[model samples]
Target chain A: MTSIAIPRPAYAERPWILDWLMTVDHKKLGILYLYTTMFFFAVGGILALLVRTQLAVADNTFVNNDAYNQIFTMHASAMLFLFIIPVWAGFGNYIVPLQIGAADMAFPRINALSFWLIPPAGLLMFSGFLFGGAADAGWTAYSPLARGSGVGLDLWIISVIILGVSSTIGAANFMVTMFRMRAPGMTMFRMPIFCWTMLVTAVLQLLATPVLASALAMLYIDRNFGGSFFDPNGGGNAILWQNIFWFYSHPAVYIMILPGMGIISEVLPVFARKPLFGYKAFVFATMGIGGLGFSVWAHHMFTTGAVLKPWFGFMTFMIGVPTGVKMFNWLGTLWRGSITFEAPMLFALGFLSMFLIGGINGTFSAAVPVDFAIHDTYFVVAHIHYVLFGGAVFAVFAGLYYWFPKIWGRRLDERLARIHFALQFIGFNLAFFPMHLLGLDGMPRRIATYSESSGWETLNLISTIGAFLIGVAMIPFIINVVMAFLRPKDQPNDPWEANTLEWWTTSPPPVHNFDSLPEVHSERPLWDLRHGKTAH
Target chain B: MASHAVATQHKQGLSNGMLGFILFLASEVMFFGGLFAAYFIARADAREWPPEYLLTPEQVASGVKLEVEFWLPFIATILLVLSSVTIQFAVFSIQRGNRSGLIRWTFVSIVLGLVFLVMQVYDYSQLHFGVGDTIYGTTFYTMTGFHGLHVAGGVIFMGIILARSLAGQFTAANHEAVEACSFYWHFVDVVWIALFTTLYIIP
Candidate 1:
């Protein structure tokens, strides 16, 4: 076959600062996304500390009632919106094009627009606190109460709408890039698993995020224009808000985690020194999870007395089947394999164990009677943290460690990574585990204070210590990153004996992603090449 | 070096931009889907369409029926649908290298869209109930109002297309913008039809 015909733009290199500020380049945009989201993660983490501090010993007055509302609400908003959701986009922006062997996203300007939208939206959302108050209705923003909150809620609404637009367009970009920009001989199935998960995630974002925009629009009208969409006395249904919010949000749960799943899928295969067991099954499972994610939004609303409990319960339980399929997929990959516990592999292993607990405890909510007991309690909180912090955050670190050398052309200190992982792992479980007992002890969520007579003090204190320890864990990670950056960029391409097309290029690939293309003959094209199995 | 760095083998079908626009339209469909679901849910929950009895005693004294005005919106709907056809024609013309025909049809479509928006605004004034009156008025105005804004947006889009056409930027082979604009106009028209059926025609 003739060599590919890439259209390289006529170029004069701008100064370094100006280049980044005006860049339509995918790599720079991806780095920008990473830095911005990690900043929010820290911000959100601080808010979580506030929450935990306020709850530490019963009736502790760390913050007043209203402030507590804003604190927890902003914590979740920053984490889910500003951090987790966009972090995957960060990783995807960097990794997807590389994995698929594309030069850049299909729409590079739109990709830049997607990244640039975030910082402003994040500022707008947090800016609410400076003006009277922040949105205290929680991230879900169940209406009526949400309708009447301070001007901050309005800011929250518009900020979220802006975010929805960003993701919606970004999703279309990801879908198109993956669909249209693979290197020769890289078929759909031969595409990296991370790319497949991102494809499903993009589909979810394309379809689901706009529904969120409409919901936010209605919310804005109700809040500002005196519309009655959620006003019960004005003949509106309150449940309508949940229906619309979760329609996006539940899929968004997958949106928040699917790429993390993608990351872990990539990591596990590389470290295990075998192909991902049941690659086709894993892809189907991802699709299954995305599909079932939509149907099971009502599971969140079971206690509202507005949903069909049995049907939602059944669907929620059924979602676990695909998730269960994934568990076996990972285990099968590890079974009888020469698995090495690299930093990335350690985090991947961490995801498997912690996410299993998250999955199991989440299924407990699928049982209607059990949910009735745990709804609006810390058990629910524990479940989410396990899934998000344990599951998504762990996978994030896995990808970060896995791709750090390639992205920065420098490797992180291994001892520090293990220290970071061990501290985080211990601190994470210590923080969230006791919440299950406290929740069963009938401690409600979002409360500013609890009475000491409630007997929740000891467990609460332990959880707070754990929370701070998790804060302590970040020190090593930050140090590792800074330390790595201080070193020279001397790492080779394919540092980990990685198997994707990305490793086929230079570390921190050039303006055009590749110098020359390699013919892909399997999912692990690099492996095939290294083993001399693929024909050039 | 420039010659050696060829574009990678991409799956052949719709161009990336075109496929992206279509996916964007799918998201638009779901956006409208949310508002429609709100309408249907609000409709289902209410004992009456307007929930007139739920009104305050002051609103009752103010003589709000909390109902939609039909005739003008119906006319506007028809106008919007016709605009869809004209925009389609504009796409067809541009595809065939008929630059004059493209400009003419796109201008006609834009004019029709503006007229439809004006008619819808006039219809909004003629309605007895304000958006604040009740859920019925809320859903009615929000859905149609959003749809109306989309129509205005589509008009602006086509106006740009028209401007580009007159500038001689389009040809048989390179008129993706015109095609994209037409897809949007038709989408806005389809949404209006749904709104008209749900809000204006059903009763």
Candidate 2:
């Protein structure tokens, strides 16, 4: 790559710790977000292993039931709130401004404020263990049960509300940045697909997160203030919690994965050596998914006997349409192109294959009758992990590999990446796949153990082995990162011959991102730079 | 490579700061939307405005329905709506480079906002029930209480605008902060009207 000099902020020369703490740079904040969320991911993963250990054999005394409940509850809480949901914001914070050719996020100080809220929130949520016990009522924290849970539940509610506020404001920042901060000649249609997905994701966050906040507040009131928002005795409907919680949560399901799908869209075309096919259709499909997300929350309540069975079931099925459009769009992007099997592509493919199973399995619960048989069972657990772990987590790896050169200015070891990918893919399936059969055979979820004669022992042991293998898989990834740091930061601006605007600048871009952005005449500005701008 | 500094600024309809504030308002709308939805759901599910099932036996034996006073809250509602107008005038004054007018109108809005909060506190003290009393108290207080908080927030927002105006920070061409403050004040005002209808005027 040709050497070029660019101006940077004065704070870049400051002591590293003080710089990170005091600086409002979006890229630095993005890295902070990534590190923080990844730490929580490890924390959540350890909790998963513990849960698996306890459930490995029937009636095994790994942990008492109460400890098991808190463990699993913290696992879901950490994964959903700390890991999957905010990781996209991490990626978005770094990449969106670069992709749009802007200097920083719309509100840089507000961006810092958004990230600063996460650590204290995570610490407070986990601090519950020190007080007495962590929140044992599960992540959902349904009405009277949560009301009766320990002080940990109160801490959980407050921490989640703080996190929600952080995300809400962060989302508003994203929309404004995307809408108003694009470079000259870049229209809405000229945006990269990831920005499009973030746009939709931000819309969902801005609208849905506040509803969750309101529900949490009501829950807090009910638990502490004798408010009857969810108390049946106080003329409050218990279903009210379900209605409001799912209202945010079902949309939140998309908030967790749409960005993953966005990452997949980004990785596919680059590896396939083709422009993303159906770019406009993919954009519309993303918006369609966000729109349909609101209607499908009640599907979760199908077993409660309070919701309209057919309506929610039908809406749940309708979600399949937009999702199917996205799936086909991805397949089209990869069709008849020079496809390569790099680590990012491998993980993207893993997401495609696994998320397909995840989507199909989720639809089974939409049948209302089938949901009755499988609700609160291992089948539901299997479905969630497939989507979250298989779908979103795979894309997270794909994104990390694909953007590592741009973010860190060095390439991770390709050989180690492949090994890491293979183990994670195999171990992920092994861990989650048996739960489907176990669910069908009547192994209920959230239980510490089953009797030896319950016939769940073999599958449980297999899942335990698979879960441990996943833990083992992280070794290669950690080694890859550490090894990459020891090498020279000699990567070119566009190492993969990628097409986005971020690739137009130097690797580990200057503080202002781009000294001079390439004129964007099309969505693929780099492609335009290479091939010369085509006539409209 | 010799660097060429090309402009990255696009011709957006609204400035970044204004757009961001508007988006912030959109989320605030959803927040209040959720609270109001809960209020409506509770109201719809009830056979009576203050559902009979939630009342204490002693309270029920007294044979009086739960009530909110129209007079005090109506006055409070007028004050908040007037504050919105005053904030808008402040925005206009700043846009016209009238710093004194900006300060005057902003101070008036802040005073009006504080008065509205004082009226709410006075009304709360006179209430027949507390937040813990019943579902009626919960929904009523949660909705209006949140709106009251927003009013307080708007007052602070206007105070910042007032301070900036006093420092001669905003001019005719660049008063984005003033405009954003007006937008929030208007949003709080609209929410107050909705709360007035839901809590005070609704029979």
Candidate 3:
């Protein structure tokens, strides 16, 4: 057997700052994304703790109503926009090419541009807090309210528009790279499921984001120019805002979840020591989820009295079937396999169990009667946090642990990783599970304080306690990351004996991903390499 | 056998420039698709489109306005369509190593694109409507405003390609920039044609 020798290019002359600032390299840009998103995640987490503390005791006056509103509003907006979306984009920028056996993303300079646009947009959004207050109309920014609010709402609108531009450019780059820059033998079917989900996610982002931009622009015009796009007095309908907003937002929800789903699909197969059960079924389910996501936007408006209730109700229930099929496929993959409970595996398992509960509760909301009972309650908050925080955030951690070695060429400490996992898992459920009970007892979300006699004191206190524990769990994970970077330990290729093509390369792949692209024999090309049918 | 195999492999992959252009078009389609969906929903719910209170209420309220006046945009549309053709000729000339033909057609396309843009501005000025005055005014201006921006982008693209061509930077094999610019110009042309039919000729 012979190994191909790859020549390393000589270092070019450039300042360190200039090198990163003007970089078209996907790897460098990916690192930039990782750091930026992590910063925002911490900021969002602090806001979360503040909201919990205020709610811990009934009628507590730790913060005034205005400050309380800003905290919760900014918390939701920061976590959803600044953290989750960018984190997925960061991971995709780094790993998708490696998984597909390519050197870098297609349109590399545009990829850099997409990431650079985000920080400025984040600054615009958060700077509002320092000036007067951040947007307090919830992350949804449901018009009339947003329009009537002060300069903070105006800033929020501009920030979202800029972020939409960034997302669109990134989506365009991803589509091109996936379609054109694959390794020689990697066909659409042969590409990893994560890449496929990304392809679908990029398409959804490209299609759906612009509508939101237009809606925001219209709202801007209405607010500034005496236009009546959503003004009831000027012959515009408030219902119009709901329609335009959800047209993009329902798909935006999938944009948040699909990438996480992709991460799990990749993780589950590897840890199960089995080929993914029903590969084609998983692909169809992914497409089904993306397609159905658009039609169900009206489900969010069922309480608004604008959309046809029965029709939205039916479409909403239809979405549940594909989601159910996905759950079955995950369980089927684990059936009778030699499963290892590694950190990544543990997180993936947590995502599945928690996401299932979220899914069931989400279906409950689709039923008109149930939704009426829980419309603005903490129950809805619990349900969505389970999905987004438990489902998406857990999978994100799993991917980070799984790919950290591949990115840095060093192993993260296993002991510290397990401790991080246990604290996070325990703290997460305790924090969110009690919110459902409080919601049923008629506690609405986004309110600063509740009366002592409202019967919500005990539940609120427990939820707050759980939130602090989750914060403590984050410390070990941060330490483990820093230690891994300081100690440069060499690891063998295929450290996990993983089934994907990425594991076949060096721990940290070269600038160009591969010396010569391998011929893919199946979805699990590394499996074929291990069996001596293919060579590295 | 190995040499033959490598040649076959080389033939299979697309040029990066073409792939980038296709992706750009896909994103543009979604951009315009969103605007179109808004138009359809708003129009469907309207009791009297262009409204009885509009500035041109006499003409619109009587419901007897000639659709032919809308075809004035078709003139600008035709000029854009022809500009796309000229740009393609320019790219083809570059690919065939005909520098003179490339230079001449590139200049002609840019001139036509500028003329079309000027006429579009003129058309907007001539309209007896303002964006906030009526539902028709709002939708019409927003849709056309975005389309005009696309045309402006196409003109800028042409300008860049022209500058690079004059510098003698492109070659027979590596003129992907010229090729991509032409593709973009054609895309702008197609979008205008669709916009023309839907907004104007369809009534």
Candidate 4:
């Protein structure tokens, strides 16, 4: 394949700083999203270390109780809101237009607006620390308690509302771009799996994030405006907060993971040397997860006694079916194929194994009796981390490694990537696996200290060690990225032998993604180009 | 290249701008849906429509009624519905190449939107209690205040359209902004009707 030598203008000649701030370029904005979210990830990671350090031994007083609450609150806030959620947006921004063969997002200015909203919101959220103290109401911010917190809670509410607005607008942009901007020959069914997941994720975000905004607004009014929406003293039901919060948040859990599932689906097919096992089924399953996402919100509130436990348990258990279908589809794609364990594939495989545990453990909670045992315990904490960190974060790294060549026109060092993966996989299990046992043995979460006689010290210390190892794992990833940047952009456009429309263009695609796209005949247009068109 | 660009634009009935606006309105629906759910929950839990918990027994005995008067807000609702119609007319006029008609109707819609806001504020002044007075006052103000803000936003949007219309920016072939403005105006109008139903006529 003789690639066209398109003359690209030199970015070095211009002032890149000013260019970045004012630029509505989708690629640049995607890069900004990546860098900003990764920074928050580091902040969140440090706070995690603080949390682990506090709990590493019995009766530890590394920080006072109030400060401990703030630390964990911000940690989850930064990871969930600032990092994991927006990082998918980052990947989607960079890859979706390229995959769909569009030059830019449907609304590039709004895309920029979405990216710009994050930093200020992050600042406002964390700035709670400077204003007396930060929000300690946990991320769920269950009311009467949340209503009673300091002005910091108000800041958190306002910040989350702003972020919700950003996600809502961004989701709309993604939907419009996919709907309106697909290249001429690509039909909806023929679209790539990543795009499919994004489409589903966007729907979840658009409809669900606003409910969170509404929840936050009520919290704000209740706290400041003498409103008694959640104050039981004022004829307000305290349980109303949980109902509205989970109504948005359960769908939000899907919002966090669905795109990661998309990334995995993309990576798996390439590494296994096959087309995706069940393209249509995978699409249907994604929609199924999204449709069922709304019905299971009460599962989160089951122990509160306000929810219909049997109904919520039934719906929550039903969620696993679609999720199981997805799991089988991934495994089926890997079976009977010429597979290789490249960095991206390793992380993809890592996501598969760990997310399985996440899925299985979540079911234990779906059983109302078991949930009664572990509700608000370290076990539930373990369940979330396995899903978000093990599932979403692993896929995030997989995506970063997979797309590094295309986005930057360079490759991350492969050997260092393996080391990073090993440390993360081992460290993650060592960290969270013990928490399940600890919870079953009656160890509550979010506490700063524990008694030595409780038999929890060994596990807590082991978890702390694992947490540090996870922290150590970042060193190799950082080094690999630095090394990749120091080297020249020498990778080919099809470095990974990929099948998507994105790989059809230049390594760092030209300003307008493509000079001309090949006639897309199926989902794997590039594969069709390499090998003659399939019988389908 | 020009032909390729045109082909890529995807000429569907709904313009990308209009589609995006509707999706945004879909999210706005969920936002208001949440507030209404809270209102219903609050109402259900209370022994009375206006829970006497919020008022001092003396104030409650002073014959202060928590019931909302329907007349002024009904008039405001009618004005808002009329504005929705006028904005649609503005969009229709633009589609037929009548820029003057578009500008005139948009200006009238903006005027009606402003009149509705004025009436709402007047109604607020005539309220039997403050926002802090009771859960009834709280839900009433939060829901309607949010709708009022959306109306204000719609007016500003129309103001922009009116300016652009005066500048002759829109055409029969291309008036996505006008169309989007109308969709948003209609959304605000529908929300006001829901609010009027919930707060004024539900009892």
| Reference-based lDDT, each prediction | 0.90, 0.89, 0.82, 0.91
Name the runs in model 3 displaced over 4 angstroms.
Answer: A1-15, A516-519, A532-536, B1-14, B54-75, B88-97, B127-129, B169-174, B197-203
Between the candidate structures 1 and 2, which one is better when assessed by DockQ?
1
> How well does candidate 3 score on lDDT at residue A481?
94
For candidate 3, write residues B9-91 as lDDT tens digits: 22345676577677667767767776666566666666655444433455456443322246568788888888988999998
lDDT, candidate 3, equals 0.82
| Error of model 4, residue A8, in angstroms | 8.0
Pairs in steric clash, model 2: none
Candidate 2 lDDT score relative to the true structure:
0.89
Q: Check candidate 3 and list the clashing pairs.
A: none
Tell me the chain A TM-score of model 1: 0.98
After TM-score superposition, the amount by which residue A425's alpha carbon in candidate 3 deviates from its true location, in angstroms, is 1.4
CAPRI-wise, candidate 2 is medium
Residue A382 error for model 3, in Å?
1.4
Which tens-of-lDDT digit does each residue in A209-295 have in candidate 3?
A: 888888887777777765556665444567787888888889888899988998998889889988788877888888999999989
Candidate 1 lDDT, B1-203, residue by residue in tens:
23435364343667778899999999999999999999999878878765777899998888887766667777777788888898889888988999999989999998998999888778777878888988877888899889878887888898889888888899998899988898888888888888778776676
**Predicted candidate 1 versus true structure: per-residue lDDT over A1-536, tens digit per residue:** 23345565644357778788888888989999999999999999999999999988877877999999999999999999999999999999999988888888889999999999999999999999999999999999997779889999999998999988989999999999998888778889899999999999999999999999999999998988999999998888888999999999999999988899899989988999988899899999999999988899999998899999999999999999999999999999999889999899999999999999999999999999999999999999999999999999999999999999999999899999999999999999999999999899888888889898899999999999999999999999999999999999999988898889888888888878787778888888988878899653
Q: How close to the true structure is residue A513 of candidate 3, measured as C-alpha lDDT?
A: 61
Q: Which candidate do you rate higher for DockQ, 1 or 4?
A: 1
Q: Over all chains combined, what TM-score does candidate 1 have? A: 0.98
TM-score of 3: 0.91
TM-score between candidate 2 chain A and the true chain A: 0.98
Tens-digit lDDT track of model 2 for A265-371:
99999999888889899998899999999998989888889889999999889989989988898899899989999989999999999999999999999998999
